[model samples]
Target: CIHDTRIIMTFLLTATFILGAVIAGVYFFIKRIYSYWCRKGVEYIEPDFFYGNIKEMVHGKISTGGLFKKFYDDLKSRGLKYGGCYTFFSPVLILVDLDLIKNILLKDFDNFINRGMYYNEKMDPLSAHLFSLEDERWKNLRAKLTPTFTSGKLKMMFPTLVACSFGLEDVLSEYSVTQDAVDIKEVCSRYATDAIGSVAFGIDCKSLKNPDSEFRQWGRQMFKEGIKGIIKA
Candidate 1:
């Protein structure tokens, strides 16, 4: 019995030491990666150990865009023109200056081609869209699609868009009389859905009138899945 106890204790001690070493190594690795912006002499938001600056986003307390908007507001209030942040050890640059953003997006777009999103073209063929694609693929697809969105094409679609806005107007008018607090984000999302449904699918979704419309449900499901994936990543 004593011999068996001695062997069990030895095994436990070895496992504990290995686990502690692994934990320490991971802590140090994250610390080094998180210091990148600091080493580059750039201003950045202080990040938490594992989730970086997106703890709230990972916890589902805020959407990704909302979190970035908060970051933008915080940095702007601090009188910063630009700042860096971390998304799980990966450094992200936030541009607050209009001229710099314009230059990066328009004048010098080729230099900033990669969006750093994950997409497996072979496994998920549908995921290989323009936004997820990189370099030559993105450029080529964008070039092909650009002409379809020209002024003439948009003007032709304007009447359909205006027709869709009536549903939004009716809903707002009804809400105006009640004077109750409104979720404008949801209302706008429905409006956008209705607009897109009308213009693209040639189906009057009427999502603003019927919040439980099939298209609206689909949109909600897709958004929830996307946010869940972001949190998992």
Candidate 2:
């Protein structure tokens, strides 16, 4: 009986040691991430142990827009010009001052040219647009696209715009007579899709007439994603 009791005591002590080590490891992991802003000498909001500052966002309790608004309001109320925030373990800088924003975008634009988004042109050529391109590539693309938006070009496209407006009016008039509750956003998106398709692609998407038009279907596919899809991405 004494031997059995000693064996049980030894097992309990080993279990306690393992448990303590695991807890300590977790604590250190979180502490290291939390130490980032402090090490940089930047003022930041204190984060919850597991979720950091975006607990609501990570849990899907608040939307992306709501999360940003919460951060903005919290910092703004404190009268901070700018503040450091965490999106999970990652640290982010939030700019609150209007004059500083104008200076960054206009007066000192070259210093912050890239939007720091990932884009692979070889894998997806369509992704190689003005928004994703960096440095000299962006400058070159801007110079090329500038000519397409010239006064002469816009004047040439005015007729197409007028035609699209008439088409939209006709589509809305029909919807008003038939449906009591029309999805205005869906209708507007369809109209815009058709208008751009005709003018730019020279192909009739007929999105207003046919709800499941090729262009609309393509657009739907682009935005479709599950949790797995997000994880993979």
Candidate 3:
């Protein structure tokens, strides 16, 4: 019994040592990458020790887009070409100079095509839609989908837009008659839902008439700006 107890204790000690060493290794590895920005003359706010730059984003403070937006404003104030921030310990270089932004978004688009956001298909299916796909796949899909959204398509859909606007105007007339304060965003979103449902899905969602419509409900629910919206800032 004494010998078995000694053997188990040894195994536990070894496991603890291994875990500690792995943790230490990761800490140093991340520190090394962070030091490069300091050397490159790019000013980065001292990343909250462990979380690097995106500490706020990770802790439900800002969205990925909002995080970059903050950096964009800060660097612009300093007249710097760009600056660096972290997204969950990964370095993100945000460029603000107009020419550089143009190059990244267009001139040499392939070099900076990826937005570096990750989404698991199983977690968000519709997100698994075109917006989530990256690399050449995203490029090809965007090209193919462009034709479906051209001015020609909008011209064809103009009649439907006219119909929906008429529906919306009539609905607003009813509200004006009642003298009630309806949320404009709610009304506009419902009109959009009805217009899109007809043109895209070929469904009649007479949401303009019925305020208690599922189409309107889902439209609002989709952009509710929840806690995730803050994190995604």
Candidate 4:
């Protein structure tokens, strides 16, 4: 019994030492990543361990767009044309100057090409979209798809947009007659659905005609609050 107890104590001590080493390694790794801006002598928003600088956004207190705008304003107030932010452990650069943005996007286009999105074509084939693509692949795909967004194509779709606008005006006009107050959120969503469906997919969502249409329902599903939306936001 004494020998067995000794063996058990030794095993427990070894396991605890290994676990403490791992914890210390991870903490140091995270600290190194977070110290990137400091090493570069750049101003940056400080980040918490898990939520980073987006605590409000993570907790659903502010929207993703709102958080970005707030960060932009804060950086701008500091008279900074560019600064860094952290998305978890990843370093992200934010631009505040329009001229600098134009230079990066136009004059230095080649250097700023990749969007740095995670893409594994083998595991998720559809994940190879333009926004997620990088390098030669992105250039090739962009060249192929550029013609679709040309002014000529937009001109061809203009009439369809007009038709959708008329449909929205008619719906709002009819609604105002009986109901003084309108759920403008729903009305505008349906209008956008009809417009996008007509122009982009060549299908009329008929969102105004059928409020509970599958397309509109699917759009609502995209905003359903839970782990997915929170993570996305």
Best by lDDT: 1
Candidate ranking under lDDT, highest first, comes to: 1, 4, 3, 2
User: Where in model 1 is the C-alpha error above 4 Å?
Assistant: 1-25, 118-129, 177-181, 225-227
Model 2 lDDT-worst window of ten:
224-233
C-alpha TM-scores of all predictions: 0.78, 0.66, 0.69, 0.81
Q: Encode model 2's per-residue lDDT on 144-182: one tens digit a residue.
A: 988888899888877887777777888888878987678
lDDT of 3 at 36: 68
The list of candidate 4 runs beyond 4 A from truth reads 1-9, 107-110, 116-129, 133-137, 178-186, 223-225, 230-233
TM-score of 1: 0.78
Q: Give lDDT tens digits, candidate 1, residues 1-233.
A: 99999999999999999999999999888899999999999899999888889888887788888999999998899989899999887898898989889999889988777777666789766467777789998889889988878999899889998988888899899899999888998999999999888877799897999999999998786567345578534
How does model 3 fare in lDDT? 0.77
Q: Ten-residue segment with the worst summed lDDT in candidate 1? A: 224-233
Query: Candidate 1: global Cα-lDDT?
Result: 0.86
Give the runs in model 3 whose Cα sits over 4 Å from its true position: 1-19, 33-45, 49-68, 170-184, 210-212, 224-233
Query: Per-prediction count of colliding residue pairs?
Result: 0, 0, 7, 0
**lDDT score at residue 95, model 3, on the 0-100 scale:** 85
Task: In model 2, state the lDDT of residue 23.
Answer: 95
Better of 3 and 4 by TM-score: 4
lDDT of 3 by residue, 1-233 (tens): 99999999999999999999999999898888777678787777567676777666666677656876887898899888888876556677888899988877777876665666555567655554465578877888779887988999989999988988999999889889999998897889889989999998989898988877888777776555555743442
Pairs that collide in candidate 3 are 62-231, 62-233, 63-231, 63-232, 63-233, 64-232, 66-233
